[model samples]
Target: MESKQTIEAVLQGKIALVTGGTKGIGKAIVKRLEQAGATVIVTARNQPNEPDATYSFIAADLSRAEEVNKVANAIHEQFGRIDILINNMGANTFPGGGFNTLTDEHWNQALQVNLLSSVRLDKALLPKMLEQKSGVIIHISSTSGQFPIWESTMAYSVAKSALNTYSKALATEVASKGVRVVTVSPGLNKTEAMTTFLEDYAQQAHITVEEMTSKLFERVGGVPIGRMAEPEETAELVYFLVSPAASYITGANLIIDGGNFPVVK
Candidate 1:
């Protein structure tokens, strides 16, 4: 059995909303926040299993401005104030070729889902945060946001760059008003969907899936940790950022790519 005391540290009294919280890293965040004593409201197109007592599920299409606003309005009406916001919703598809083959539609799709979704949610919710003079916003970005890959998923990388910049600027604009905003940029992760992507790549490359995975890892110069990150590992950083323990951290993009994006910190 888990100890009650361990469950009390990361979120004792925070009220949190995590977009895309139904699966993968977002789902892990919902669980971790619940353990720390937060009333976690998770928004996605679908609902996850109901096992955690403090968790609430809201189904909505975050990619649409109207839908994003509806979700925000619901939270504002119910809670009147939000203590934390996690912008975790994003969408992208594996590209068959490099940037030359990426169409205008693909670029627009990336921007709409990955960039504008965060913008809309923040716009709808930040006023309350400003009025309260305290809150935290976490942007779940990607390593591609900065050190982008040129051949595959290039448009998604470009969109994420906009997101990273937007997050930094928003953090500065609101920090004086007592709101903290930060970004978490993860490298390639071994989520369920990513695993499926690997299998597809293996078939396309005419090699064993395991061989394809190894070659892909090699192309990226090998993850120093020798593996892709578990969703919970990324969520743990998020748990701290929204907590009082990380009150001083704002406007910074923290990368967790197993030493894949070598930055000096």
Candidate 2:
């Protein structure tokens, strides 16, 4: 069996950057990477309320090119290089009434947040990884990318689908250069945002939150494990992917959906 000390220090001396790292799945990833002894840097539009946060934080709106550049420059100046990049910032805040309910603005926002932000960030930070000839880039995607809930996640899923394709292509391009790129698509996670979403959705549907939660599970083809995933559970997979343990994994889109996906890939 691996010793605790060995596992804890698996990522020692590594530098990691996790976007949208203040909450939800992003926050969990930050904690997991830090526990593995990696120096972590986080970026978000606002500072987190957590008083005991020790990770370096940079405030920047990732959707904007100028802001992305600002963050990239700051990271380069401060850390010089990054060994792990987790593109975890994403959202699905839009009207939910099928395709006609979505406007151009909504589409653009979805694309910006779910797809282009990672693209721009990768462009900005990838050079250093290429220079060093080693790095790991993980695009935190969603199961909806492949199995979109047309009425609600149309725009978000579309963007994530594009992200999935982009991740694979980027992985192929960089694999020969000693850099590894992968995508992680997680199903429903029990994060604060998810809880709030369920509450609002339940109110809108005039149903109890528990009922709404079950409906969601059914909509996703029924999780065999019978529950939503904890953010920390997803974070552990990310930790492994970014560490030396997953050295041979690249160009793969790993799904953590508790057997919800209808078919095996």
lDDT of 2 by residue, 1-265 (tens): 9999998999999999999999999999999999999999999999999899989999999999999999999999998999999999999887787989999999999999999999999999999999999999999999999999996789999999999999999999999999999999999999988898889889999999999999998888899998889999999999989988899999999999998999979
lDDT tens digits, residue span 160-223, model 1: 9999999999998999899999999988887876787788889988999899889878877788
Clashing pairs in 1: none
The C-alpha lDDT values of all candidates are: 0.86, 0.95
lDDT of 2 at 193: 80
TM-score of the candidate numbered 1?
0.93
TM-score, every prediction: 0.93, 0.98
Q: What global local distance difference test value does model 1 have? A: 0.86
Clashing pairs in 2: none
